[model samples]
Target chain A: MAKGLDIGTMNIICSEREEEDVVFTQQRNAFLELDSSDLTETMLDSAKVLYIERDERIYVLGEDAFKFATIFGKDARRPMRYGIISPKEKDAIPMIKLIVERVLGEPGYRNEVLCISSPGEPIDLDMNPLYHKKMMEALARRMAYETHVIDEGLGVIYSELSDYNFTGLGISMGAGLTNVTLAYLATPVMSFSIGRGGDWIDEQVSITTGLPKEHVCATKEKGFKLGLEVEYGSADGALSIYYDALMTYVIKNLNRKLAEVTPPKVEFPVALAGGSTLPDGFLKMFERKLREAELQIDISKIRLAKEPLYSVARGCLIAARTHEGEEIGSGGETEEGAG
Target chain B: MDNTSSPGILQRGALIYYVGSVTFAAGIALLAVGTAFITISRIHYGSEPEKIILSVISTGVGTTLILTGINMMMKQTRYGYYIVGASAFISLLALLIFTSNYPHNWFYPLISYVLTLYIAGFLALLGNAFANVILWMIEGKPEAVVGREREIKIYTDEEIERDIEEATRKSIELSASELKFKEPGVEEVKLGKTFRETRGNITKVKDDIGEAKSLRKTINPGERMKSGSVEVESVSRNLGEILRKGAVQKGRFGKIKEEIKDEMKKFYSSIRVTRNR
Candidate 1:
């Protein structure tokens, strides 16, 4: 059996193939610490809030954390920032492990292959994702599964660009970082992360508006759209402003990064994925930016993934399927080492 | 006309321009008030030389901000970012000066510290706002800045070899764990359901282990020779026989080793090492 796990900064999603259809399970990668009290515990239990009690502190986990943070006007603590395990969050490891287990469930069988999406090396930040990837691999191993680490952007390609012979540009505008991959025949020619994404927008909006990061995040996720005029002082306005800036930054870097490489002479089809791209008019805004960028390479088309939020997980499943096939063909010995 | 500067782009750019202008005005107003406060206090209180020096410095900074703001508004160059950065630095300096000089009394320092913080906060906000606006305005404009290369990890040959060796070792371990033996013609029909391993797996495992052991011996024969003279003599004798065999003709064994070496180099060079992490 094969499974795909997209360990995103904002959400952890798992994909499992059941015959012809693929099913997905997701959990918000966030938590909130509330005061420990019997009444609070009773209230949380009555509300059915997903939480854990440790050392006399009630830590609300997953989607409920966002709700509680918004209620309390506090920022939801993230287990990951900028597409890796957050150094700022003290309980990132245990929290993320619990969240992953909740979302991924148990492996179908022992040594079931689990392909996890990991962000590529960042271009704009001095961060090493190896530690994050290894931690995730170890977590998967401890759960009694073989793990494969695939590039986040490459996962988008596998999910959305099969018609292009897996040759195209995949951009995952995730919460923590925008991962970009230019692939040919399912092989990544170039891949890197921009170190800024939805979280950056939330932080920027929070700083500008004096709103808690969670409040800004809620506003952004609550029916926000790009290319629409909003009140300049409002949270949605700030979100839109930063979203524009983020798209421009991504395009500029894409142009510059693409210039450095000698890519195959093909009209590349670009596919966009991730939660950040789910906002209305996002594709149109991104297309506008791409047109303005006047990139040196030919772009055949710009398309959004059918399900941007699940694309990475689905792509991971595709990869895991192929990897499992290869392992079977090789008599249970894969060329790639266990990650 | 080029689509790069369409009405939509211009409208967006214009909005940012106005925002930048407003932020610049607010920053200049704060700096102007700060400069006026310093001047008024220095003159009314007949301040010390240090106070006079600070007043002059504040005047210079206030003037610089106005001039830079005007210059940036006109030119919209990369220097706009530098101006905002310099303003921020000046704000920080003013805060440090105010706090250190007025250390004796909390009441006096608190008021000035709050004012400085307000100025610093405005400057920081302005810096961010200006950076975004300036970046938007300068879209697609190329600059020959150095060291902007993507930080993709390029592994050295040694690192690549180490990774391959690690993978091979894991493959060997997997082979060992999943190994199965079959006796020819002994319940051959029943073997179909229970034979979890393939015949080729055994052969491949044997070949890989034998090759690895031989390579290890060839690379570090001295380690084995250190144990005892008898072992050393045996290794020397084996080496002599191999040398004699190779001397007679370019044997398949020697050719295979050379081919493996060549293949290793090719593999190392062909693999594009993008994933360093």
Candidate 2:
């Protein structure tokens, strides 16, 4: 069986086909460090919180880490920031490795093809994704899986725009980065990322409202829709402001990038997928921004992925399946049988 | 051989060229029919995105093939082979897109027949290009080919493996020192002696003093003590020299500081004198 792994800043999701159904497993990509003690260890055990012990310290992982952070009034440390491994977080590598392992589990078979989604080099940041890509590859190889890296935005296209003949624009508004891909008939014409996303919104809102970033994030995720009115100094109101700004930034870059490349003169159906796009009216807000920008290329429609968070994983699955098919065609064998 | 020296259009090369041309024309006709089929499907389906996309792709491929075919026939140069090769690859890609669109419908008679026809057309296009390449190669290395001659080499598996091993060996030799330097996990302190030697020397010096004390019981205690004292004095003298060298370096630093202070004093006095004036 082939697998798809989406290593996002906020989450690590794995998608695989089991029999006739597709199974998705996920974990929040955050951890909280606590001083290791017998009492605390017993408490964690009683709570059944996922954690690992190293250097005499306990790291609470996944969603439980967020809960722990909230209870302690501390910030949850993320393994990634701005779509890549955080340089400031010393434990980013080990933390991400453990989370990916938990999410992916053991491959169905040895050397199973695992297609990983990697963000493109951000146009606005002086960051290179090569090291991160190689690190993910190394992790996958350590798990005895053959790995292939797919552009995160292109993965979205494969997941959502198959019916459009894969000719459209796919944008993943993730937590740390927004990836954009222009694909024509399954071929990526151009792809890039911006180093601003949900986390940026949370931070900006936090700064404006004098609230903790974690508190702001919690408020934003607590089912507030975009374009909703709230108290002037409230978290939701600040969130709305930042969300608008983020949309404007994305649309402006879209215009600037589209001007540099001549895409085929066809109306493109844009697919938005990621955690950031989950809020209600995100598509409507993005559509408004795109209309205001008045890009040269025609846009047929803009829609959200059915499962925004799982879209990249699903795309990776599709890509892995394609690769498996090619491998089978080339007379490669598996333990069970030829797929 | 000169072109005039060869038997005219009745030659095998000419025959293959004619056959390629005919096959290409037939393949193009089939692609045109495929486009029409796509259009009909779109009409029946109320212009669905997938059908429309398929129609556009088929029409585009059909148009490209026609243009390339005209270019090849009119130019009649080896460059036509290049165009044909590119078109053949594109047609195969188109076939892949077309097949993937309705993968489950391959069992349906209409879909199966259309797919078979498309495959046949693609093969014909590919075959035409292959035949043209053979004709070009067989006609002789013509002067009008207009480029540097190309060389194609085929290596056996063993030869390829040997070459790779040779390259790996060279790379390993080149990077040996880099790998060795990088192996130390922590930053190494550069010193005149290895840590082990420095540690062993200190222990040996202590052992020598202890041995001298032990010898005092067997020999003249005063003489043994004098020899041990001489050894200690020499060691202390070397340490004193090192300390003296460090003091000299510190003195140089102090001298530079004193010079700076004097310059500051002079500047301040000059300012005071001007103020007084």
Candidate 3:
């Protein structure tokens, strides 16, 4: 049983690992982060597994419920899913039980409330009205309090503060989605994703090289950065394809949004956050590509989070604190009529 | 979803190679059938031009097969290249034997023999190249997608209050004389020493990770940790510092208002169901 409730925010990165050949889109650089990876893993880790596919990629999400002969854990088992319901109702039982245990920490937790957060835009723009609420409610059953969102641009705020105001683009990269938060006025103006983040990168690298995803990741860890010619002809040039494809969105879709956002007072910069952005120089590559496309954005102004991975979660904490009537430090100009 | 073709230079090249090899093979097979028909019946398969076309058809079939094989080979098709190569060689050898068998048929046989030999050689090379191309295309197993989701829990109302309280204290840079120590649940007691000054000395009191092991150790004496006597100031001296720094002011007009409102909602929401109970 876990006592202290661990809270975090995840800017879901739609890496190559999560999507197939096709890259997912970054929703207005909206954040799709979560409080913990544990809750997601629960529905996915155990027995029954299910997935969803939208926009050419497959998503293995909702884990099935299972008869809990008594199962629990603090560390991850493997391969948690998120899309929809698992094979059987019972498949999700074990995971749900673990969520319960983690929040309540043993028998005294039958009704301890749990609060979670989501990427700002997706939850708001979900075509399915109940899609998000249902997902949050499903989570609520395991814990007590369930909050889907902390506040818009919450994570970006923490990231900007960490980076001394977007000297660079702050990317909250994750699996299934990637959120880009661009801060110029020491606050986020807008963020968008080019899809094909870490997961897709991993998957493409493995498939193209005949190597396992884990091996590729290990190699990436060893500084065998993608976009370079590998031992076998760049495995059909995954990185080249990835960058060209993804950058198009950054150029076409996101650039347009950036143009539209007329910042009134402050000049924010670019910074990156999230696990996907944790890789060394991902920000630089993105910046370079954007520049090459003649967007002519200044790369020197880019800022990387001191701890790229934890920025989003910490931002959620900031969000939580703000909700408590506590003060959150300031940076960017506030949008008029924004609730 | 960004709907764009994966069609890049290499993909386009591969597609062109595929189409070429397939058409080449189909054409050669037709040519081979034409040759077989004429060879079996000694009759002109068609008019003079038609007979030539028939012969060309057979030659084309052989050429297509050879080309397809070679393309596969270029793509690193281990087996396809070998098979194509072998078949092309066999066809060449067969053409050689047949042409040679018609000894002394003069110029026509010689020309025919040379043509057959050329077809065989070309086909063999084509097959080998195609095979290589196909093999190279074998990137073996495709990679799998790895999904990641991180979850963090929102604090209950009481926990939020505690965090806010602690954060407020930490925010202030206080003097040594202004510090005090407060004890459990209620009441503030001043202890003229600053927690900051004693924090290095306060190492024995582990930060409240609330671990079972720590709880066990605290209960036991061998660990030499603080017992019931451990205390810190309840009223943080940073209160005045907050006013000076204006964190409150910044948080209010800037981002903190939204953040506070959000957290307060979560806190109350957590308390909501429990109150119902």
Candidate 4:
């Protein structure tokens, strides 16, 4: 069986097909560090915490880390920041490996195909995605899976645009980044990402309102409506303000980038996916922003993925399945490598 | 037209005028012959003066056709074919009238009408051909402009082989350089610890802790008091030293607890800022 992995900032999800069923397994991609000591070890051991030891330090990982942090009245730290491996986190690689391993488990067979989703180069940030992509590929390869890298936005297209013959615009509003891809007939013509997304909105709202980032995050996730006027004092109001700004910024950049390339003259249905797009009224707000921006392309419709958070993983699974078929048909000689 | 000029370059206007002049001269000759025949018949056979006038009218109509053709050719008019058609019609009408007058000898008028028709048709065709030629001349031939030619060096077979060999050599060198630029794979990456083993260990520790707590809760107070008295009797010999040591240990424990409480307070305060907000 082939696998699809989405190494998202907030969560890491792996998808595999079991007969006619598509199974998804997820783990929070966060951790908390504790100074190593006999008492601490004993306490953690007694509590049955999932952790790793590096440099004589014990690090609690995944959802358990968040639970421990909440109990201890501290914040859980992320191994990935802004949709890539955190350069500031000393244990980022090991932590990611642990999370990925748990989610993917042992490969069903040697050289099992695993297509991993990678974000496009951000237009607003001076960050190179090569290191993160290579690290993930290396980790998956170490586990004996022949890996392929696919753009996160294109993954959404693969999952959602099958009805359109993969001709559409796919936008994945993830936690740390928003990826946009314009694909025609299953081929991507243009793909890019912006550095602003759910996390950026949370951070901005937190700063503007003097609230904790977690509180803003919780409020946003708890169904704060956008594209409506709201009083300006509350956390939800601040979140709504930033959400509007983020959407406008995304639309403006999409327009500018689209102007640079000539795409085929066909109506493109825009599909929105990922965690940030899951809130109520997000698609409506996005549509409003899109109309206000007056983009220079025909948009047939604006759609939301049925399961926004799982779309990338599901699309990656579809891609892996396609690659597996090609390999089998070609007698395993031609391997689809990363672009 | 100048004799030195190529016939291909002759202006269509001049050619039309030349054809028109020839047709006019032929029409005048025909008119003069018809007029003379009418005058001779009137003088020798005492033909009617009205017949002579009719012949004169025919001559006048022929003169009008010739003049119309000349005007069309001179003006380079597109309506030149109408002149030729009118000429043919007038000639046929004149022949019909002449035959009705001389029913016994129709051959002469018939031949003249036939000749007139032939001349009219020829003029029409010539006018059409002239118009086409004028159009073609006005739409001049495309001129071929020769810009500076690139110097193409023709290589001998030996030279071609040498160049190919040189290109192959350069490609090999390029590949070698590319290999040098290739990045090395990561070698020291370490995987983190598994969740299941840690969970198992924690479960065992939890069970042990639970058992210890339950056992402590279930112990009887009377048995505990008896054990405490026995323990006190056993430690009575070094009770003063033990008491001093216990006092020092309690003070140290207090300091450590205070520090831990302060640290916990800091951690809680850092994460609980949302409450203040």
- RMSD to the true structure for each prediction, in A, is 29.0, 35.7, 32.0, 33.1
Off by over 4 Å in 1: A326-339, B1-277
Q: What is the TM-score of each candidate against the true structure?
A: 0.54, 0.56, 0.36, 0.55
Show where candidate 4 strays beyond 4 Å. Answer: A45-47, A326-339, B1-194, B197-277
For residues A93-192, what per-residue lDDT tens digits would candidate 3 score against the true structure? Answer: 2333233232223222454222233433332122321233244345444344323342223354443544342233555555434565555433445544
lDDT for each residue of candidate 2 in B1-277, tens digit (9 for 90 to 100): 1123233211123333354466558548857876777756744545665665566566646654654453344213434455466655665565665556553443467556655655555565556545545555687645312222235488778668856955784465445422211122433222111211211100000111111112222222232111224534555565555556656787576655655555444433322100000
Each candidate's fnat, listed in order, reads 0.00, 0.00, 0.00, 0.05
- The prediction achieving the highest DockQ against the true structure is 4
Clashing pairs in 1: none
In model 4, pairs of residues that clash are: A45-B202
lDDT of each: 0.70, 0.70, 0.39, 0.70
Against the native complex, each candidate's DockQ, computed on alpha carbons, is 0.01, 0.01, 0.00, 0.03
- Decoy 4 TM-score against native: 0.55
Locate the minimum summed-lDDT window of 10 residues in model 1 chain A. Answer: A330-339
Writing each residue's lDDT as its tens digit, candidate 1 over A1-339 gives 688899999989888766445677777899998887888877877676777776677788888888898787776899999999999888898789777877777888899989999998898998878678877887887788888888999999888887777878999999999999999777788888999999899899889999877677777787888867888688778888899999999999999888766798988999999999998999999998898888867888899998899889888877776656532233223222211
Summarize candidate 4's per-residue lDDT along B83-138 as a digit string, tens digits. Answer: 54565565555555564555345477675775575456445545554664564456
After superposition, which runs of candidate 3 have C-alpha atoms over 4 Å from their true positions?
A1-115, A120-130, A137-142, A146-148, A151-153, A162-169, A182-195, A226-231, A234-248, A259-261, A293-300, A325-339, B1-277
Query: In candidate 3, residue A41 scores what lDDT?
Result: 38
At residue A201, give the lDDT of candidate 1. Answer: 94
